[model samples]
Target: MGPFTFISRNSTRIIAGAALLGLVLPGLADALRPFLGYCVLTMLTVSMLRVDVASFFARVRRPLPAICAGLWLVVVFPLTLLCLAVLLGPPFALPLGLTIIFIFVAPPPIVSAPAFAMLMGLDGALVLAVTLIGTVVMPITAPTIASFFVAETMPISAVDLALRLALMISASFALAFLLRRLLGPGRVAAARPVLDTVSVVVAIIFALGAMDGVGARLLTDPGLTLGITVGSFAFALAQMALTYAVFRPFVGVDAVAMGYAAGNRNAGLVVAALGVTQIDDMVWLIFALSQLPIFFFPMILKPLGRRLVAAHSAVPNARSLP
Candidate 1:
């Protein structure tokens, strides 16, 4: 097989290796930080290039599940985190709480989510539908929710952040459409492995950018850095478990897809919007550590997904039963 094919086939390892590189080479992350917006746009565009617009729209037309996923992701989940922050007022600093809220409120990781779902033998179409809606609505809902939680203290104004998000998302969609028009669906389909390779490479750039300053923070405050890293992993796993349980009763095997979306947020989007310089060190540390689960969870989740799919299939009229 060609290099692209090999890279695509080993995407999980590629992601893990890229993440390891980011942790070890903090300077590379700092170097790439300036171009994070372009990197994000490229990742989003490549992800969208392989989508079937017609099927995506058709799924949108059946909007119940998508809306449920959106509301849960953008609203309920953030609010739950906000409430927890409020209840644990002393332990959770205002800035750290807001940072946590920002991470949860952000849209699903559009670039790798569908690919991850497919890798696990789950419903990629369902993931695509939910992620698209969540991403498109992020500029509006994210800003509105963020304004309530963060208000004047936010590094960027709500309106400005929303505008940037809208522009980036729009530009990605437009570029992806242009590519699809030029390449045609047949070519796009045939080039899935290449696109996957491109997506993983873009993810590596993002990982590097996300890890900017993380190593320095680790050296400066080892205890705080370690605490936040562990906390981030716990939070991610808890979010996944809760979301899966809640949706399993209603959606069966698709619950795993929703859970993945809930757990793997696009914290990079928030990081890009706020800019690395604008964020506090603690907040940056948390955000950087949160990326761990997003990159590595696929390894743990793939076998679980297969088991869930098999279990669901064994049931009579599983969809109706749910």
Candidate 2:
């Protein structure tokens, strides 16, 4: 079996998807640039098709957890990173802060809810619900938050974001609905493997675009690149720790979901937003490279998550009491 086959069978395909993106697309640099937007459209389309909107939302039988997850994306994430960026302050500080805020404002990872549900052992259905809701909300939230650090570049207001979001969200929902309907219910089970394969292809193309977006800058400043990578990894670890502290009191699975979501910012969106300006683009190379941390975090965390699951399962009378 291919290494991808191994990853496909596991819950860490999100990382694998990113790695494939980084490695596979640079050769197609010329073609990849103009079409990065289409590459994004494909990923989003696949994500939408995979979602069962009615079924996903139905799982949110309660209001509080859903609300908390929303708050994480909209408020807590941005505010926390803004504080961190201010505290860090410089060559490393402003750019790193922009990376954090760019992603904070960007849409949640395309696969985050599902990946979090699987890896952290949360309710996949509920996670899916939250992800869908967050996505619809992102276009508005993203530009607004992006404006704080990047005022000059972000001339488009939240109203524009709302309009753009409506278009993209509608496109996602439409394509997904058609694809799923054509696949049919029984055949849908067989499609996961196929969809996973396609996701890898699209991911590589997306990564290539990301690489090209910053390739020139990366070639110029090795020190800045190194600093951003190290700093980003540190930030990721901090976010994960914060997530665990916040959500552990609620449930282990919930903690896992929040931890991954909080830690793994969508690098594609981060890169795109930073590309809004020439100066921002120059600094964004480091931020783009910084995303390597997410693609690696799973190796250590996955095994630990499994152990936590086993330990939780072993708790005497816990299940019965609940």
Candidate 3:
């Protein structure tokens, strides 16, 4: 098979491997460090390319529930994290590594939520709806949340960030449109594999850099490093559980998929939108650790998803039977 086709076919395996490989390849991290900004932008633009704007607006016509879900994700969820941080006091809220706090304040879920939702037999359309709304709401909400928690340390003020975010997101959409226009829609559509291959490569590069110093930090301060790592996993699962619980009655079967996006925030999107080129290793550690649930879930979720799918499949049959 051609390299692009191969990559597209095996992207999940490659993505999973990339996360593990990052732990061992700090050199790859160094090589990719300078280009981090561009890498972030490239990844964001690629995501924009996949967005079906027409379909999104069509979905928007009667999307009150999805809009609320998106609001909860980008606004309420981050505020919730901040409240928890306050209640828990200083021990849980490290100044440099506000890991859990960052989770919600960051952008929406990774661009693959719709695909992941489909893979698990969940509501891909709901996932897409929330994702689209979250992206639209992010520029305004991101800085609002970040300013409340990290104002002094932030590189830019909330207003500046809001402006930058607006420009960057707008430019990305413009870039995507320009590319499609230049290449033509059919040609662009035909290049899905190629675009996916590029995204995979960008993700691999990002994973490696993000994991830089993580090993040495573990060696130097096993307690802190391991603590954050474990806590990230725990909090991630808890977020998913809580989200699933809260939305179950209302959203039904889609709760699992919504929770899937809820727990895994796309920090990379925040990094890109915030225009932060260099992040501290402590911060990077959080970014790296946040990735575990996202990368590993697909492996473990299949059986659960299968069971859920089976249960729902049997429901209609049961109803139809006398």
TM-score of each: 0.93, 0.78, 0.88
Task: Please identify which of the two predictions, 1 or 2, would achieve the higher TM-score against the true structure.
Answer: 1
How many residue pairs clash (N, CA or C atoms closer than 3 angstroms) in each of the candidate models, in the order given? 0, 2, 0
* Residue-by-residue lDDT tens digits, candidate 3, 151-212: 76666788887887778677777898788788877787788899989988987777666666
Runs in model 2 with CA error above 4 Å? 1-7, 10-31, 52-58, 83-100, 104-106, 116-122, 147-149, 213-220, 270-279, 315-322
How large an RMSD does model 3 have?
3.7
- lDDT score, candidate 3, position 87: 76
Q: lDDT per model, in order?
A: 0.79, 0.60, 0.72
Tens-place lDDT per residue, model 1, 210-257, is 788888877888898889788788888888789989988887777888
Q: Residue-wise lDDT of candidate 2 within 166-220, one digit each (tens)?
A: 6766786788888788888656656767776676677665555555544444457
Worst 10 residues of 2 by lDDT: 270-279
Least lDDT summed over 10 consecutive residues: which range in candidate 3? 313-322
Model 2, global lDDT: 0.60
Instruction: Estimate the lDDT of model 3.
Output: 0.72
* Candidate 1 C-alpha RMSD relative to the actual structure: 2.0
